[model samples]
Target: MIRCTGVRHRRLTIPSLAANARQIAVIGPNGAGKTTFLGLCAGMEEPNKGEVTLFGRKPSEVRIGWVGEFPDRTMLFSRVYDEIASSLRFRHVSCRESDTRVHETAALLGIEGLLPKATDELSGGEKALVAFAAALVHDPEVLILDEVDSHLDEEAGRRVADAIKSRPGVSVIACTQNMDTAAEADLLLYIEEGCIRHAGTAEEVFEHLKETCFYPAVWRVRGC
Candidate 1:
């Protein structure tokens, strides 16, 4: 479980959103502090007034895997295979097992052919895949994603969704802008002005939000 209290980032004062081991989705308009809130949850930033925790443990106490919006930044090694296999090798995984894990993740992400290619040479989407491969190799208890779909098309997005669903015991928290993305979410949070206007299942919040927020009316209801 992760928690935030009196969370303030720069000018945004976010309320404490406690995640008690369930999957959560954060959504709202751009600049609504969704990413900032996620950063705090991921322990990338210190809060202005409150604290964050993971199951009564700090983020350091719990292993965290992340796929940032720009994945190329996570790449360090010369070759894609090296970048993917680096952590596994560091953990002393057997050579045969490490190769198998890397190839398996690559095939799952459709980047197997790029194993020998330089990490510096892959496209943005391909780099995203490699970064994802690296994150999943260690299999952390929690995965935090920030706008991971920016560069992906619909098919790529589905592949990611599939990967997320098949995993077990790993809790996921994500910040996204796509309403369609919210449809796949089990728990959805609608944030407005850095506070939660609503937090519930995707259907419960998303359904009513359309009626509450003002939009150009298409037709007049029978009310006069």
Candidate 2:
């Protein structure tokens, strides 16, 4: 659903990225350009060097839901319900449908009780869930999540993972340090420095990890 050719921004350079999988995981070390790469795919940032296209259109023109590493960046409204409902409201969805979608999305992320809470009062993990809910409510064709589950606990993380996995038509490209989450993805891309060092199945990427001496968190998650 997405393609990048010689995509470069700042220090990162992805020679090529042809992501056709419905669920793709971007696993990499700190400062490995994972977020930069995601921004290119989301059309949030334009590459100074190459091209990135999503679903045959520019990333900005495509319908996509994105959640960044920081939840606060995604927050605009003060209330949780309004935050999740914002997307639907922007599209002029009926109030009844918007309300239903808001509540349903909150419930899916196990944050039903939080619907009445204030956005500023939520914990970091809670805010993350809210941010994710906001992205999911509109049912965008592609979901770009940049290390969104980092602050979430194991259960919350699984909830997020399960929710994304259940979406039949939405393609997801998540950048995560959580190897267990990466392991569940349909495809894996291992990035280092500013390049995609390897792009393949989980096993194939892990094989490449075996050759490296660092043995990062992803390797630990794989019991390597």
Candidate 3:
């Protein structure tokens, strides 16, 4: 479970919020503090007040996998294999085990063929897959994605959605502008002005947004 109580940082504020769903989508306008909320959840930023916890422990104490909008910026190693193994290496996992895990994660994401290639040689979509492989190699309890699908093509976006589905045990918190993608999440958080205006299942949240442009176009067309 992920819980936030009296969280206040910068322009974002949450008096109370708890999420136990396996997949939660954060949707909002460009500057609605979606990333700020994700930052707090990822432990990348400490809240100025209150607390954010994962499974009863502070978020900082939990193992989390994070993939941001630009994976290249965070890519530490040039080689794909090395990049995927970086986290395991930092944790002092045996080289053999790390190698096995890296290959497994790459294969899981259907990026094994690119493992031997240099990161710089890959395309943008391929880079995102590699970054995802790196984040998933360590089997984090929570996976946080910040608009990772924004730059991806349809195929790449589908691959990301499939990858998330493949890891049902890991709680996924993704901030995305794609209403269709957001509609697929188990829960939705509609944030605005640094506050969550709505939080519920897709049907519930979309009902609240049905009159607004934020509602899924497909749903609107279907009158759903």
Candidate 4:
């Protein structure tokens, strides 16, 4: 579970929130504090006030996997295999276990073939896949994504969505502009001007946004 109480950082604010859903999607307009909320959840930045916790512990104390809007900016190793193994190596996992986990994670994301490739040589979509493999290799308990699909094409996006579905035990908090994708989450947070204007299941929250462009296009076509 993720909880926030009187959380405030920069322009973002959350008086109180407790989310136990497996997948939580944060949707809002540009500069609406979506990324800021994600950053707080990922423990990338400290809240100026109040607290944020994951599973009864401070967010920084939990094992978290994070992927950002620009995966390239976070890439460290030149080779894809090395990048995926980086986290395991940092935790001092044995060589044999690290190798096994990296291979397993790559296979899970259908990126085993890219393991031997160079990160720089891969295309944008391929790089995103590699980045995802790196993040998932260590089997983090919480996964935070900041508009990761924005840099991906349709097929890559589908692959990512499938990969996320494969990890039902992990808590996923994603900030995305894709309403279709947001609609698939277990819980939705609609924010504007740094405040969460609505929070609920897709149907409940979309009821408040049916007249807005933020309504899922698929729902519109279905006359929902």
TM-score ranking, best first? 3, 4, 2, 1
Which candidate would rank higher by lDDT, 2 or 4?
4
Q: Candidate 2 lDDT, tens digit per residue, 1-224?
A: 77888877887887777878999999888998888888888988899988999887999888799999998976999998899999999999999999988888888888999999899999999999999999999989999999888889989988987898778889999998777678778899988888888888887777777655434565666576
Flag clash pairs in model 3.
none
Residue 3, candidate 4: C-alpha displacement in angstroms:
1.1
Pairs clashing in candidate 1?
Answer: none
Steric collisions counted per model: 0, 0, 0, 0
lDDT string for model 1 (1-224, tens) is 77766766665665667656457888887777777777776778877787777877767677777788888876779999999998888789999999998988778877789999998898887787778778777777888888787778787777777777768788888877666665566788777777777777766776556654311122114221
Residue 131 local lDDT, model 4: 85
Sorted on lDDT, best first, the list reads: 3, 4, 2, 1
lDDT of 2 at 63: 77
Q: Which stretches of candidate 2 lie over 4 Å from their true place?
A: 211-224
RMSD (Cα, Å) of model 1 = 4.3
Candidate 4 lDDT, tens digit per residue, 4-44? 99988899889998888899999989999988888888899
TM-score of each: 0.84, 0.91, 0.96, 0.96
Better of 1 and 3 by lDDT: 3
Model 3: per-residue Cα lDDT over 81-160, one tens digit each:
99999999999999999999998888777788998899999888898888888888898999999998886888877777
